[model samples]
Target: MATLPVLGGKVFLTDSGGAKHLVKAGCDIFMSTGVTHRLTEILGFAAGFALGFEGKDATHPGQRIKVSEMGTALLGQAVAKPVGSGKGTGLSVIIRKRKNWDDIAWRFTRQDGS
Candidate 1:
């Protein structure tokens, strides 16, 4: 696990099963991959196999959210600045492993209004 110090506490990040040893922020995958065409193989094999978001557009990763146009664009209705309406409102994005092709198909179908 990699711990990033926050203002009040630390945020710990971990990858229990992946190949890389050190999970430093902004680390280029190629240097740490330790396999032939490992990056290329991963890219071809999966879309969201990434432990965290892709950082090519930005300089770093993990700790700081990518502050870029595509990032902003994802938050289609986000405010001029990402300020919480009040202190209690916490924003987050959670990714979990999905099971069954039907479950996945339903999501794609819903998006298509089919």
Candidate 2:
């Protein structure tokens, strides 16, 4: 097997067998697996938000790196056929709401009318 992509110092989920991996959104595998697997959210990731991901396009191992969009909903869609050979590994990409200190402060202020 090829050396798989690893999302070090990044947010990721662990499988039942204790494998850590990062997957893309809109992938057929993710859609299917998300339904059956109970995914756990990992916290304490680096700053900035990840919006979404595109399928792997490079035929060579090092040719393609996973690309992600920032500051948007994590919605998964089907990847293009040529790019996504359905042979990709990893579980799936997960999207979480990014809340900054300002956002939190404002929410509290509104609730308390302060």
Candidate 3:
């Protein structure tokens, strides 16, 4: 199977025993619209896979809800900012590991006062 070059050598096995590389954290999948709904959708898919939200049981609804809400809020913030205000027009989705989700979310929440 093809693997992303940025993943380097980190690999893991799926339930089906297929080998896959772990996505690099803080990697930016860029697009024309920075933080727009469309961009968020792309980012969400990457986040979901990196965070193990794919083909998983819904036993952890709370964590899922938090991530969803955080994404929404981030989208809103991106939309609210003016396009040419030095923030640039490109959007980058930061992909992180499942283990670091809580700490990352907390930092974002505290930083944004949300």
Candidate 4:
């Protein structure tokens, strides 16, 4: 059995020659010794329930999975600003101001802008 580092309170594990698995907090893994183990020990074999290996591939134990190229492009399109909008003059400005001011106007305006 292969084990990965705990990150964000979740553990990722993979078999020697098979699919990867994500083990969340409080989940139990049963060992071959007929004893139960938590996320700290060996994980039992899981088959037929593959979480697709597209954007979730990690090369090293603690390496983070990054947004795939297609995912990044799609996200950029989804949040793209309209043409002719002035730079740093919209919600970004409001957010910057709200960090220093707790006034009712700033709070309400930030909510509306968000």
Q: Which candidate tops lDDT? A: 1
TM-score against native, each model: 0.18, 0.16, 0.17, 0.16
Question: What is candidate 2's lDDT per residue for 22-65, written digit by digit as tens?
Answer: 44433323323444343312221221233222233444343455
RMSD of each: 18.3, 19.7, 18.9, 21.2
- How well is each residue in 1-114 modelled by candidate 4, as lDDT tens digits? 445556556554544235344544467642322233332233322211122111222333334543322212345475645333465322221112223333423111223475
Model 1 poorest 10 in a row by lDDT = 101-110
Q: Summarize candidate 1's per-residue lDDT along 16-38 as a digit string, tens digits.
A: 46754434455533334446457
lDDT of each: 0.45, 0.36, 0.40, 0.35
TM-score of 3: 0.17
Q: Point out where model 3 deviates above 4 Å.
A: 1-35, 53-114
On TM-score, the candidate that comes out on top is: 1
Candidate 2 has a TM-score of 0.16
RMSD of 3: 18.9
Residue pairs clashing in model 2 are 26-76, 26-77
